[model samples]
Target: MTIPQAQREAAELLARLSGAAPVETHISAVYVGRDTAWKMKKAVALGFLDFTSLAERERFCRRELELNQPHAPGLYRDVVPLTRGPDGRLREGGDGPAVEWVLRMAPVPAGDFLDEIAAREGLPPRLLDAVADAVAAMHAAAPRAETDPPAAMAAILDGNVPSALRAGLDPGRVRAWAAAARAELARVAPALAARGAAGFVRRCHGDLHLGNFCLWEGRPTPFDALEFDEALARIDVGYDLAFLLMDLDLRLGRAAANRVLNRYVARGGDAGLLVGLPLWLSLRAMIRAHVEGTRGRDWSVLLTAAEAHLAPAATRLVAVGGLQGTGKSTLARALAPALGRCPGALVLRSDEIRKRRFGVAPEARLPAAAYAEGVSAAVHAEMFAMAATALAAGQAVVLDAVFLDPGHRAQAEAVARAAGVRFDGIWLEAPLEILRARLAARHGDASDANEAVLLRAAAVDPGAMAWHRVAADDGAAAAARSAIGMKGHSMC
Candidate 1:
């Protein structure tokens, strides 16, 4: 790709200021200095975007700052000009006619970029949780958009094919994938429209992937939002999240992807969004396939991933029930990544539901009245309802709760039966001493139960337990997996 003369001059000017070479992409060049980085939009006319004019670049530079500043804070500073002084020398932020524009940002350490971190140490569970929290936070604050989601999706599908073919992908495969994707979109069109009306459509981070995230201020922060096109940036939050999910599935593994998905939902992402996840993931995979093809890289794996996203998967509901401190939530989370679809099961915990019911964070403590019999019943009911909703969407679900009341256990099974899916119940058990110690050590947990609650729960006979009884120990996950007949299955 030839560097246009104007962009070349701008890059050179930025390089001089930064004392480093510019990192070039198709549409922009970034020069990282000791304390700052300057990003200059290339003077080019790609079919999807046109930044050829100086005025247009300046406008987009400002737009980029405006879109990303709130999410990244001090990282996105301001848009400055590359000016031509009377001496005919190009200068950065000079008082002369502006020749080009650049977005200035705080310099991010190369190793802090999520993609580099993934490549080096791999994403740890804590970091993956943080990543999900960051995305959920962004979605919560995103401005709602009124665009027709179905039409927006259709337009994206239509735009992908020609570019994919032009990038030398197999024409037949591209067309077939497009056809299947369109069919899936048609099937879910009503759900998409309903979600749009409910305000799930928003101006989102248009290009959410590992490469665009970095550790800033010791937290995973998203940056470099797609700025050139408002149409691309405005989308369903689920679709925005899908890019990162797809990237994680491909780069890290399905387990990592599953962790992020469950964590995101736990942080208040709508479970209803699961209905369109397969289609969204397929589209994201296809985007990567063509982008890689264009860069003269092997895109076959990504193409295969695109096809796999639309493949049907078995769905079931698994219930993990036990008294407080038996580690039901732990086992449920461990088992969820292996169940059902790519990113795995949604774990609906009664504790988290109860917290949400009272408009509190998961770790917030509630008054005794909040856990009264009536409140507990309502929490169980909400958990079952959420499970049913997810199962109906062809997603697997794991219910995490203490089903001390036989009635609640029966209701859980009934929900699965109604959804026409298989159900497995695992009852975790532990000695009173062990349970007491576990409860006593709990901190910042959703469960408010302590030794007193544990002793009380222990005194109540969970009548005629018919579920698989597994010892609540380090091997609990393995025992639960075996009891569920998942011995040979590959975990996500």
Candidate 2:
């Protein structure tokens, strides 16, 4: 696509700040300088998004600043107007009638973007739990919409299909997928309408993905939210979250995707949302396929895979056990997606459960009594109860805890047996010194285990263990393979 004259002029003026060049997406042109980034909207009209006039662009820029600040603090700066000075030369932030507008932002570390990090690391890291936590908090704080969500969503889906066809996708495939999706939507329309009325529809980050997130001082900050259309951006919160979940399932693996969904649900998001997940997943997948397809890229594969995720899979129960830092939670998370269904299995972590039981934040440290023998039993009982309930409902389950007692391990097995599902017990272990070192490095985690806890756990003897024993001295990937072997596959 050729650059329009107005954008060309804007670029020439943007270069005046620094000699750096500008990067362009379909909707906006972004120029990244040494310490800052300037994003100028393309004064063009896409069918769904319009920025045909200077005033409209400026309004959106200001809205972008206002909308993104609460979720990504310190990331979005002022909306600077591109204007002409007394001289004929166009200048940014000049004192004259504004010619255009750009949202100024603090430059983020390029390498810290989650997609780039995932590419290099070759596995989904545990930090994803933090990402899920961040999103849950953001959703909780977002304002609910007053419109009818079913109508809003139906309109968006209607637009997405035609967009895909216009983008040169195989018309037959697009038609089939769209029809199925619409039928499903129609079937669930009542639930969608009710969820919206119940405050589930909200102004949300409409385009959430690993690619849109970056690390700021070791914390994941989501940016570049959809700002073009209010109708598109404000809808069911599950639909907003489905984008991230679908991306993770497609790119990373099902386990990775499941971790985010299960993590979000465990972190106080409505577990009932899972009932509508298939439709939400279909909608997000269709939108993604349409976006890429319209760009003359093949998107049929995504449509196919996401459609399959809509189908139910046989449920199984997997239990992962070890002392803290033995990589139990990490392995369990990595193994989840490949286990049963679409987004994978629900991992019930004991630490997060204990925190919930105490009505405290996951990162909040609890007192020593919280770990007393009686208290620990109660926590395990609650975790198993939740896991069993989900399993009984045909959702796959993975219970993550030390399972230090024979009775505790037996109870996990019993839950699966009573549910008539296959069960696998995994035991992760490493040298005491290694466990101590790993525990000491923990920072800002739900697990409050420290070196003292590690030493105490090491002293206990877990007798008559019948589970598969796996050495976890290696890193996360190796530990994961040791636990689940070749059982994991991304839902392609």
Candidate 3:
């Protein structure tokens, strides 16, 4: 329950390890003795959680095992009980009462942690998309928990705001922002309650930051989920995700954060949850601000970041059109983070839409009939409808498709006009051979188009090249940068 007690016990326990000593954090000490590692919770009580007793420690240990099993399988396994026998010797798991509880887990590659990787290489578009996909899947599979929406939010505000005030921010400003946040949550309480009723709330990874996610087997797997408090972890999916979004925006830039959000929403994130995103993101920033303050770090930077993310961006429509090998999707993704709100724009790619329409994976090979005129028309119509809705609701959108036909291109522009938003179109052009090579090299991608599709698209008579034509033979970097005026994804 006290600091000295925890320190002494951890020291004695870590002394038994044969290899390197364990690493210490605020709550836990992790010993990497051999191939396996042991995580032992400190016997301390905080305002949020209490692991003062052996039984309390054991219960939370089990919770870490249960809640983390979905996204972090093979990492969290077997809660080891450090017990005392009749002879007074300490060992793991026995009939005697557990003096302490340690969660034994498989060691992940220390060098490949997402945070470390991002710090070095900066999370590329593909990896960021993969993280979004993983988070979306985790949210989809996590079961909901019934929670009182207003009261739950109020608790966070009351508990964390004081800490934020102590972080060198003016009391008046903190109070004013806190009041505004509470009022906003009240206005959207019904939507939040509905989301909870719909099973959006669940046992989520409470502490889902870059540090917790590691690149294992070339895929990002999130580990060390929150286990101490169910009330904090069992929340609406958007709130659970807002932490990562805020974290990314702080560590990277808003564009990087926006990319993650857009991708997550594309992969079945609840559209309804967006209404409360600002508050969730603000709360997350406040927590970070206070935590940094406690460590005697200048947390004002986080305050600036919090304000920027909370402020919404203007919405518009951007469409990238080209043949199969013109790198239309790549340009759209680059430009998507540049336009509209945080985490950029909603990327509604026709290839992804077509795959969904066909009820097949992105890599599935569809028959020729799948790309028939009727099928092609349906894809364009659906993409426009979705884009129109997002634009109307004040969200920026990027439509990626082969608008080789004049009619399809006109229709896309018409959709933007109907939504009363400014529309910008970029048409990419490259040699047929280049297109063919790009298509041949593609694998496991959302686009199912092959060399045949490329040739067919090249043969089409796209009347009157009116849109901003860019030579994509040498890649669309210069053109993309010129069009969007993006600083090119600034990372922290």
* Residue 327, model 1, lDDT: 96
> Which candidate leads the pack in lDDT?
1
73-113: candidate 2 lDDT, tens digit per residue: 77897998878877787887877888888899988766888
Alpha-carbon shift of residue 471 in model 3 (angstroms): 2.7
Instruction: Tell me how many residue pairs clash in candidate 1.
Output: 0
Candidate 1 structure quality by residue, lDDT tens digits, 1-492: 456885677777788889998788888888899999998888899888999888998899998899899999999999988788878988877888787888999999899999999999899988998899899989999999989999999999899899899989999999999999999999999999999999999999999999999999999999999988889989999999999999999999888998899878877838999999999999999999999999999999999989888888889999999989999988988898888887889989888888888977677899989999999988888888888889988999999999998998899999999999999999999988888888888897889898878888888988988899999999999898899988644642
Single out the weakest 10-residue window by summed lDDT for candidate 3.
Answer: 483-492
* Per-prediction TM-score: 0.96, 0.81, 0.88
CA-lDDT, candidates in order: 0.90, 0.79, 0.77
In Å, residue 197's CA in model 1 sits off its true spot by: 0.8
Q: Which stretches of candidate 1 lie over 4 Å from their true place?
A: 489-492
Question: What value does the lDDT take at residue 330 in candidate 1?
Answer: 89
lDDT of model number 3: 0.77
TM-score for predicted model 2 compared with the true structure? 0.81
C-alpha displacement of 79 in model 1, angstroms? 0.9
